[model samples]
Target: MAASLFLARRSLRLPFPRIVRTSKWCGVPALGVHTTAGRMNTNQQDFEKSQNDLKILKKDPGNDIKLKLYALFKQATQGSCNTPKPGMLDFVNKAKWDAWNSLGSLSKDEARKSYVELVNNLVSSEAPLKDSASLSTREQYDTLQVVSEDNITKIFLNRPEKKNAITLQMYEEIGLALDEAAKDDSVITVLTGYGDYFCSGNDLNNFTSIPPEGKEKMARDSAVILQAFVRKFIDFPKPLIAVINGPAVGISVTILGLFDLVYATDRATFHTPFSQLGQSPEGCSSYTFPRIMGLSKAVEVLLFNKLLTAHEACKLGLVTEVFTDGTFQKEVWERLRAFGELPKNSLAFSKQLIRETEKEKLHAVNVQECERLRERWLSEECMNAIIRFFQKKAKL
Candidate 1:
């Protein structure tokens, strides 16, 4: 929702994680050299362990559990919900279909992570999910990894193979994650991505997958979603941080304006190619970018589709600091963990003081930008540009 570009979806597939399945996962450490094999190995290890643990459970985990596990297994083994929906009268498969389909466009890796984390929780003699505050704790995210520890709530955009692109479902999930983080006890919140890329941009499938007659509705709805997403940032009470582990694009880059701190790796680059995609800036970038950088520099980025290296963005005040890629995560997260130990209400109050005066202006800019984007989504220019993008992509 915070993106600028309407980029093509990554058509490539990652090799399946061997023995991948569902279990609960949390406390995700900062990623280091997140190669394909390393990710597969970690998830596979958890999968095997959870399966072994599942075999020894004395009691059945119940129908709901069965459906969740089945759905997760399908998601982990296959990808997304590409299967046909079950007929309504067929209660059993219908329930299963509903369960699986609810995952939306969740990538297989994220589904595997969710599956592993859920299974781990269920294996517990006292499952936190059963008759407890499961909404904040046990409910598995389809496209994100969220955990609160060390007084810091960390939200990871968990789609690595697609370079952490923001799918339509991911947009919703991120807003929800931020909502939960805001209400939680954590003194600070951190946002980053899984694997290689911070985020490429909004998946253009959000636009291309429109129903035959739904383009108008889709555009309007997307504008509303984007508006709300930016509102979450504007109104967030706690200190929000962005840990830019790698290259960031689209909303991922633009939305840094709303964050309290943006720590990036030397490898990170910031890009917002809105004009190239026939889109306008969302995330209040129109207003904030000019304020953060000069109007001239902001125009270079928002209009001319400029790409900024981490150091360049830092120099422009868009990023707080840039660390060498070798120690980026270690150094940034160490400081964040320490910062999270600060007095909670004081941090929140201080952040509110910093953001309160501009909250109204930010909200207005979000509305204005989303309105422009809504128009762009249906424009002839945008349609032609998108068609050209897909055509070029198909050849690749």
Candidate 2:
């Protein structure tokens, strides 16, 4: 994101072309472009060409990236966010304001360059996804293996070496996979891991490594990413399932509240050590955890860093069922494949009815959790805690 911000800023010395939104364009946005002939340098020419290409794209680059592009364009063209922040209930406008405001005092030239580079990348990378939609060709993602078959789209977390711990790129990839699955003909979408562990949660490197943009900015960017990532699950249309092949931790465990069904292996454990790292709740766990497991149990895991066994999690309503380790995959897949043959529309509509009333509350909780986490990430306690964590790991 920092690199993209640099490229986007550098490319913006020239004016970007205006974007017209008619529901056909992807994430290019609807910024008004300046077309003064005198300013049409080679860079501006490339920018305009990129704009043209972006308007032709049929696939979205996900909501987070779109907000990013929108913010960059706004900063590049009209200077820093000047409009009054929208009301709390105005989700769309408020989100737009937040994205643009997160840029802080980034100069117009920088914003322009960032917007152009992002647009170019979006245009270039989009075709591959479109072509890969067919069952004959699986969707290509950097950190996820997405394939549709037997009326189900299975998204496998492919970083076994990292215990499937998610990186920033992985978050984006998973969201994109979910977007693809949501619209595809698949009756169900299954999230699982490639290795023995379902997901060990956050890749600590994300916290330890500070980019040139600095820690606070990275935290801002990460919060944006986090909100977008969780939003995918919150708004997912199909029956989303978690096939917990093994241990799950951090956001991986927190997000299960959003899944329609969670099947775990008897050996699988769930843990959320938020306070251990001086971080606050995220993945909307602040609300969902207490609601699902009651206040006492939620406080134990979320505040005191308690870990839960598979059976315990199941009893708490986090996991729907648990199978023995040896037969976990075989039994789970056999049942899932059967479930896939169910009526897609019926399942979708039923889920909608079940989820409709709570969607707004979930979205609100997501915003609150993400914002709080962003502040926590920028706190002295969190930074020092992460440093100590790395030091402890080195000794072991």
Candidate with top TM-score is: 1
Q: TM-score, each model? A: 0.68, 0.65
Candidate 2 lDDT by residue in tens digits, 68-98: 7678767876788898999987877788889
TM-score of 2: 0.65
lDDT of each: 0.74, 0.74
- The runs of at least 3 residues in candidate 2 whose Cα sits more than 4 Å from the true structure, single-residue gaps closed, are 1-137
> Which window of 10 residues has the lowest lDDT sum in candidate 1?
18-27
The window of 10 residues in a row where model 2 has the poorest summed lDDT is 1-10
lDDT of 1 by residue, 299-385 (tens): 999989899999999999999999865446666777987997789999889888888999989988999998998889889998787
Off by over 4 Å in 1: 1-138
